[model samples]
Target: MRNVSINQLDDTPRKVVALGTDYSHGHLLPFHTHRRAQLLYGATGVMQVRTSDGNWVVPPQRAVWIPPGVAHEVLMLGVSTRSLYIEPGAVDLGQRCQVISVSPLMRHLLMEAVAAPLMYDRVGRDGALFDLLLHELTRSEVLPLHIPMPAEGKLLSLCQTFLNKPNAHQSPQYWAEQIHISLRTFNRLFRQQTGLSFRQWRQQACVVLALARLAEGEAVTRIALDFGYESPAAFSTMFRRVLGQAPSVWLEAAK
Candidate 1:
């Protein structure tokens, strides 16, 4: 159903419900939960999804799979979304949130699904399309766009602060000192809490944030300098390392 709230159709006796909506730049969907699992696809622009455990950045033409009842908030930038709310028993993509690569066939399926009848025929073409969609979702590539948040109070606070103004050059010792822990202990604790080493986590954070800025049309050179990179080339190196493509190439593909 185009532009309709899921609450109004949550009880529909169907395995999947497709909805499409468009959001202006900088739109925010506050923390909310859904009775059914959600495959939120961004046909245009980017999406930043935040849950209790972490944050995920969904670039244009990708999607984020949100498990049933997982409370989360979404910040949409110039996004037009096609959402599939599926019954929990209908498919099991994963237990955790995932940013997945959307293939061209799957993209067309989503577009068609969103335009199908709200109570589409279970024994007809609409049903066949949705069935293929579920299969495609199972085969979709999971992207490394998630930054797991720490649960420890002090460390979590420090991590949150860093996200506000991320810098590639921020030393691990700085974070350690801010939390009044020895550098060694901090390293161990950081990995234990977030399942990522300090260096890896910092780079992931920078790339995710840089993506949001890039979507807003910020120059790569400025973003690189803001993140303390010596040059745009240096920043692009890190970006390519993490995402497997230079910023310009990725952005062009996204367009």
Candidate 2:
């Protein structure tokens, strides 16, 4: 099923349909919906997934779980993907979209699953492989790679603007003034709407955004300064805090 579109085999009558596809750098998959839940794995490069509710960044060797009927758009940055389109009732990863860390065994299973037939045997080796893959999926760790969007009118607009040009130094007071609210009210509202404090949300957004640039080969120093960090060391500190590894180490592992 390499390089095949899921639309052509969505009704295969199987519990899961696997497809492997390669995308050129900067390729965009316009907004689309699937009848089955999707486990979209990026074997290389990075992926940016966006829906009405939020944006998720999937780095190399990781995957994003998309529930059925969720309209989403994907920006593929040099990604080679292994996708599992599962019957909604067959697995329950979750309702919301999330980036998950793919274990080595799960990665191997994905590679083999994509190579199996579209209608693989139900009681054969391929079937067993697919079964284990689903089990591994349930055990996969959920990463903190989601940037939820706010729904309030003023707050949404402000957040959108900030995403376009994220500045780490942007203070909560600045957003409060822009929305004509006091700092206290703004902080409370931001947490209520996005489920994250202003500082936490800002840092997460910057880290997620920086991941794409870093994957595209942008120098860390430049990205750090551009994002308003005082130094590359300072930027790496924050990146490690959120992601559990330094940028260079993370990049190496991703490679």
**Model 2 agreement with the true structure over 1-255: per-residue lDDT tens digits:** 899878798989899989999999999999999999999999998999999888998989999999999999999999999999999899898789999989999999999998998889989999999999999999999998899999769999988998899899999999999989999999999999999999999999999999888888999999999999999999999999999999889888777
Model 1 lDDT on a 0 to 1 scale:
0.93
Q: What are the per-residue Cα lDDT tens digits for candidate 1 across 200-229? A: 999999998898889779999999999999
In candidate 1, position 58 carries an lDDT of 93
Task: Estimate TM-scores for all models.
Answer: 0.97, 0.98
